[model samples]
Target: MAKTILVVDDSASLRQVVGIALRGAGYDVIEACDGQDALNKLTGQKVHLMISDVNMPNMDGISFVKAVKQRPAYRFTPIVMLTTESQESKKAEGQAAGAKAWVVKPFRPEQMLGVVQKLVLP
Candidate 1:
């Protein structure tokens, strides 16, 4: 079975782009507009990975990562922050929140897929 990825971002276009790329790469995708929606979509499902944006209307990526860690079922699930913020401080914050990797926005599909491949377990 293909791995399932949850992508959280406020931009619909961004989500679409990432979804297409993930699906094309033979992964299943679940999209959410922000952290709250992403949490709702969790539903104790088997999400192999997560890609989230930093700045959003409801809960942000860092906070979302923290919340995800609190859940026993998803505590070890890998997360990658995909955002426009490239600051070292912000990256540190995401790392502290348990994100395993970071990918900046306007990313090439192949680049994102490479990281996903590294993080997603077989």
Candidate 2:
């Protein structure tokens, strides 16, 4: 079965690009516009991974990651922060919030896919 990945980003173009890459790699992709929207989509489904943007309306990626970790069902799901922020502090914050990896914006699809492949739950 194909692994499912939830992608949360406020930018429509980013979501589309990530979705295309994941779909091309034979993984199922679910998109959300923001942290709140992503939470709404969780629905107890089995998701192997999540990719999220840090800056957004409603809730930010860090808060979302913390929230996801609090949920028993998704606590073990690997989360990757895909964002423009490159500062070590931001990356540390994301890690503290339970994100397993960080991928900076303007990323090559192949590069992000490689990280996804490595951290995705089996």
In order, the Cα lDDT scores of the candidates are 0.96, 0.97
Which runs of model 1 end up more than 4 angstroms from their true locations?
A: none
Tell me the spans in candidate 2 whose CA falls farther than 4 Å from its real position: none
Give one digit per residue, the lDDT tens place, for model 2 in 14-106: 999999999999999999999999999999999999999999999999999999999999999999999999999999999998999999989
Query: Root-mean-square deviation of each candidate, in angstroms?
Result: 0.5, 0.5
Which candidate gets the maximum lDDT versus the true structure? 2
lDDT of 2 at 11: 98
- Range of the 10 consecutive residues with the lowest summed lDDT in candidate 1: 113-122
lDDT of 1 by residue, 88-114 (tens): 999999999999999998899999999
What is the lDDT for 72 in model 1? 97
